[model samples]
Target: MSDAVQSVTIVEVGPRDGFQSVGPFIPTPHKIALIGRLHAAGLRRMETTSFVSPSALPQMADAAEIVAATDRLAGLDAQVLVPTARHAERAFAAGATHLSAVLSVSERHNMGNVRRTPMESVADYAQMVAMMPAGAAMRLNLATAFDCPHVGRIGADAVLALLDPLVAATADVEIALCDTTGRADPAQVRALFAAARDRFPEVRGWAFHGHDTYGLGAANVLAAWDVGIRVFDASVAGLGGCPFAPGATGNVATEDLVWMFDHMGVASGIDLDRLVDAARAVAELPGAQIGGRVRDALAARARKAAA
Candidate 1:
């Protein structure tokens, strides 16, 4: 808190989160282009793709090729979601520097997501970390941390309890508390963040990822930032949704969140104009749509300027 933030790191998840939602296979070229566009936009941290089963998510079938394309970019912390040891090895081989180990805080949700218990998933990740290449980063994304469709309103104790085992098992791992269904309100977000900071003082990284289902994603993100947490995960133009959760909506839009920080003079190290263009380009993908208002506004502004 001593030095002012000239820029912030908004982890671009559109390539992974946004592309994975659609059912059909998106061409490798387009996926590579989207990643290239985001990396070129000065977005330092980005989730390039997921190394899940092709049968499950055909959209991410070309994950390795995407990683092979983007990981070599300069100053880029390209990440890939690795759910198992198999995926971890593949991700590492494909040239992923950052690995995201995804799990849900809600028991039923975790079961539905990866078909494993929360603690079981944690144990799996511990082994994966040991085998990971030297200096490769690992981030654990705890989805459904706030509320779950299966079990509404997860209490703070339950969240802490789920994390306790994971924290004990893993050393030097980053934790990302997620509003998977976008059901979290600002009050609960601040309270949980405050408690996590208090209990896990030694935690090296504490990040947040929220959804816009209840129209509170940006508010919750700002609330988290107010409490001294900096890292965020967003989809370009808000082009993401949880396919597993019914009615689960888009992740907080990259352009809109950047707009908020820009107006507030809080630098996120992301270029707004270029980010809007990236969002627009991703929205053009088959079955993809732009959900962020800022990107649309940017288009209109571009049109008026040309006029």
Candidate 2:
């Protein structure tokens, strides 16, 4: 690998994607503390919360508080996920400067997720760009871009068709292709990303969000990385699941991704030991469904060494 391709940025999504999946409500103070710990462990960018209906996602009811708390932390880019134009408005109003606007690529997933089609979501994206304040940044998260639980494999054409309008509208945008069901193979990931880069050379950057339901999270990430994607979304302790997509599991774990990169000589600037500590704390949360191999393996290794 060349000097340019030897590093990456891992955007922490545990505070939003991971926390929202838990049945029990984690206190706002606890959420704040975890985010602080994550930042201290060298995570500069994070998906802190989502601005949505409290009835729909009770866990994100404290979005404003989380944003305010993270704002106090210098050098931290706290990104909030907004599902609609209205939600984007609310997020910007709450002092969130970085917004992650999400909409699935699959028609079935889009309808089930936000009650709109892909084209309607594109319209909302335009509104989001218009309302975005000066100097603010936005990332377009194209969920279910690879494979959808409702409709099976989503072709590269379907993903590029949606991106054509969104990318044309703005010169400043980062795109993330999500493996919503964790069923995408490495070949599919490489093909879609390569095609996207070829089609839209003007896009600022590209990211990949993958889940580990079928144990291909690391493999898929490597595939995207090979194709020049530098940013990635990962949840701490592997805690996540799509509320709208049935049978989908948690996201790729932060520890697992970090370990993979560290061994491969790829710089992520994250402290793996401290990240494991944060993940262990998250795992202790009541009713939290955590998944990841590195945390448990490290703990076991420590025990064996002590014995």
Candidate 3:
């Protein structure tokens, strides 16, 4: 870890990203309660839900209700993913303080996932950013920033090119490099973050969304952390996968990351025990399986101590 990088922000995406991949639907109240528990655990940032069409992503059909029911932490910032302007409108109306949008660097994945070419999606994102409410913040997630499952081996230049228009637009936006298929390595993560930092100096915040497909998620995270990137995306109990990307798995686990940060002496302001309990509760939900080693290990330790 860099001496200059003292603390990192962990954005919990389990409620939205993690839960959406599971087959059966989680109840709206359950989702809200889960988020509430996360907030109580000292998590100040979370991705609550995605504002997508119900017919397309039935899992997220209750997005509006979840947002409305989630209790806002005093200083917490909540974000909702939006694929289009209409999604943004609904998300903003539903009381989301932050809006997240995605544009894949791979043309094929962009078209396949969002039904628009990469270029078209970029233009659409720019339009949405411009139309955002005055006080609302926005972030652009560059999905498949590393290797694309469909197109394979997306170059750093290609990733930077996609960011060009967004940079020029001069909107208040942050960029998160997403390992959509969980295929990124340490070298790829370093190179991408270095390239993004060099290209877009105005981009205030840098985040990484890594998948555990190859079990390189934590290693890649360490690589980014060494390079001054702080904000990271993780899911509770490791719940989530990309429906479009076959063989993909949930993101890096929130409890695992919190444990790592605690051991590293990095301040995350999150209570690991509370987060672990929340993860266990989430795991018990239908269609959700627990996925973090720390949570499981801690549970074992508790049982042994009791015995």
Taking the candidates one at a time, how many backbone clashes does each contain? 1, 0, 0
Best by TM-score: 2
lDDT of 2 by residue, 1-307 (tens): 5653488899999999999998899999999999999998899989999999999989999999999999999899889999999999899888999999999999888998899999999998999999889989999899999988888989888899999899977858889999988889999999999999999999898999898888888899999988889899999999886554455557999999999999888899999999999999998888777787899999999999999
Q: Each model's TM-score? A: 0.94, 0.96, 0.94
Alpha carbon lDDT of each predicted model: 0.83, 0.91, 0.84
Model 1 per-residue lDDT at 105:
79
Against the correct fold, how does model 2 do in TM-score?
0.96
TM-score of 1: 0.94
RMSD of each: 2.0, 1.7, 2.0
Q: What lDDT tens digits, residue by residue, belong to model 1 across residues 1-307?
A: 3334555569888888888887668889878877788877889888889999988888888888888888677888888898877788888887787899988877788898788988888888778878877788889898888999888899999889888877876748889999888878998999999999899887788999988866788999989987878899999978886554555458899998999888877788888888888887888877774476788787888899999
Error of 1 at 280 (Å): 1.0
lDDT string, candidate 3, 126-165, tens digits:
7787788778888888898998988787799989888888
Off by over 4 Å in 2: 1-5, 242-249
Q: Candidate 1: which pairs clash?
A: 8-268
Q: In model 1, state the lDDT of residue 67.
A: 81
